[model samples]
Target: MSLELDINAAIKAAMLGKKEAELRALRAIKAAILLAKTAEGGNGELTEADESKLLQKLAKQRKDSLEIFRQQNREDLAVKEEEELAIIEQFLPQQMSEAELRTALTGIIAEVGASSPADMGKVMGVATKQLAGKTDGKAISAMVKELLK
Candidate 1:
């Protein structure tokens, strides 16, 4: 199923199950889809790439909120953010392990012919395209930088 259709089904299932966090996440996903649709010059329907990007953004937002809440000693809020993150993550593809990511990055570095830190940009460009929806860009960038140096 398309990500949007899957999300709608999940929302229905969450409602029937009385899963509050999942319900909230479902609504957030719907809102993001609508926003993407209505954004100036945006296509009415999101491409798969667009949906993946949106989901990634949502995950990042939840993670950032969780960290901020923890920093402020708001355990309750942090817990809520963590719950939402879990729900959101259910829709994302399985993430790469650190070792897997390192292996992939090494291959990408070689493919891009990156020889030094000066070639970081070339390595990152190829890695991001290959690893999108599988790994976090920031993490990939850090790994590439470390390997290049």
Candidate 2:
């Protein structure tokens, strides 16, 4: 996959630049890719969709860790996680802005005739499929609730 090439290039650049944060994130990504390739039942190669899903999973883990660090007042750990999160997120597709998400959700809501929260399931079934990779499910659901209300 082109992702492997881009990641290899990034790793070299980060090493040359001596960027600790970038180096750490890149190595994690590289390791994840390697593991994925070697995992049973997986092809030795990753598809574009598979790679994107992998990156998103890494980003989510970082975010969860970051939040816990913040809650426990672990600024040192939180800072490192934040840096990694930023680096990991760069590989994900650009996410929709709030206004854009709202507009898109509104259209979906109308399309599905979801005028009440009771109809959220109907809207979500379609919205999640259509908007996959564009935004987080939590963000989409929160916005949907607001719009429906």
Minimum summed lDDT over a 10-residue window in model 1 is located at 43-52
The sequence of per-residue lDDT tens digits that candidate 2 reaches over residues 63-136 is: 99999999999999999999999899888888899999999998998898888899999999999888877888
Off by over 4 Å in 1: none
TM-score of 2: 0.91
Candidate 2, 81: how far from true, in Å?
A: 0.3
TM-score of every model? 0.91, 0.91
lDDT of 1: 0.90
List lDDT for all candidates, in order. Answer: 0.90, 0.91
Residues 1-149 of candidate 1 have per-residue lDDT tens digits of 78878988999999999999889988998889889989999868888888888999999999999999999999999998998899889877788999999999999888889999999989888888999999898899899989998
